[model samples]
Target: MKEQKGKQEGLQHDELGIKIRSNDNPYLSADLQKKLLQPRKLSSYFIVLIESGTITYNIDLQDFTLTDGHLLFAMPNQLLTPPAKTDNLKYFKLLFDENTLALLPQQFSFLVNPLNAQTIVLDSAVKERVIKVFGILNQLFLLDKQETDTEIILAYLNTLLSELNSAYFKNREPVNLLNTNLSKFIEFKLVVETSLTEQPSINAIAEKLALSTNSLYRIVKEYSGTSPKDYFINRLMTEAQRKLRYSNTSIKDLAYELGFNDPDYFSRLFKKSTGKSASDFLPRQDLSGE
Candidate 1:
């Protein structure tokens, strides 16, 4: 099964898009998935190089079966799930933060695109080293909360992400040195991340990118089935749900805050998209502000 509520996949988060959950979490899932469509994936990047007994993992419309050792790299917001029994499933996943990634030199031509996946078979020696890094991370989690600089923590996290990216792309042929289209996709996502709030419309985004609306739509729709408007609205709704579930904001005020002119309209749209009323979506209405 998939985790519920909030945030885009990978490094994105908050009430706007898929949020890569904090790195401190050491998630180890043993639950079997029995759903048809996977729960929506967050906009965060997923770095998974784990071992499994016999399992199937589907990421970004690509399916890969694993026996003991295999690496998987899933890009942000590509729905993820498995269609296998979860009995005794074992795996490790590392989710990185976008802010941390920004510090990496633009010249560091590493594999950021999911289509450019590189896999490695781990012999005993290699496996031990990789496991050791995860072990250290687990140890860091147990350490008493210290007054460490946030930047220091981010530095450690970036180091971990770089190492994981390297391992996932080692000894692989460079077929797609990089696609210009893919670069556009990544750039589009960043623009959405930073500017979707000011109600940046499709026309505005297209003009900014110097792309015709039709051309932009064709590119985004080809990559992701949803249109630009739907994608942004879905992004908004993703955040709307998070705030509804996790915050103390009031419904009417929140509606205005999200750029909806009418409270009733926002509520209707929220329900239509999420299959639940804005009020109904809250984890506990009694806890929210009136």
Candidate 2:
């Protein structure tokens, strides 16, 4: 959907305290502005692939430039400056909340985290497939206006995300899961992506995958340098950032959605994770259009 005229991803802000904002949502009406839009941070993560023209993204005070077929991945809340206005720019920008992205397998999820600067500028064919995803989104959305059309459109969205998981992610050239047994590492991450909030503790996560907590922790620390708890929280906060910045949901409601029993506690935890109060980061806040 066209989240807002200025933002691409989804809701500018919601209760979750995450914003996956984008310069242009998938379906851009021809009537919309075509110039290089000013750079801004969204509520969710940034997955941008430039098809043509000059697109510059400043991450962590460094400007990364891209031309045709270059990919740019920005993690949550990375201070970014908009590209200098220009023309001849064709790009696909995907802004997905941490909640949605946590649904992604670990092997691929880290690709976008700012902590990892491994930007994979795929060959033309891979770039085409990535662009095709948005093509599907744009086509379904740009057709005739009807509520039923959106349901079909959402199905298309699911297809793109699923394909991304299987093609580029699961089938990639094999690599060791850091140092600890790779198979166990992949398994643990897989379960977390599938059922994030569902995992309660280290023991519970280990039990589901047929391993002892000690085994899991040893490997988790070996590869990722963090315990399972820290890993899961990272993913959870990713979602929180997307929702809080984009949607209309309130902080209390978003906390409840994320499995928090107390909205107040959720607020405190959110502050710890993002260093900003839920209300401070909310997009298009409760203010009404005049």
User: Which lDDT tens digits does candidate 1 get at residues 128-223?
Assistant: 666666555444444523433333344455555556545555675332425665566667766776774566889988888878899788867755
- Using TM-score, give the best candidate's number: 1
Candidate 2 lDDT by residue in tens digits, 1-290: 33322232342222222222223443344334222232344556666667787766665435688888777766554545455434667776666666644332343434333123435566766777767876666544344334333234445556655544344343454343353465677677667666765647778889987888888888777656788888788767766765675577888888888888898998998789778898976774321111
Report the error of model 2 at residue 3, Å: 43
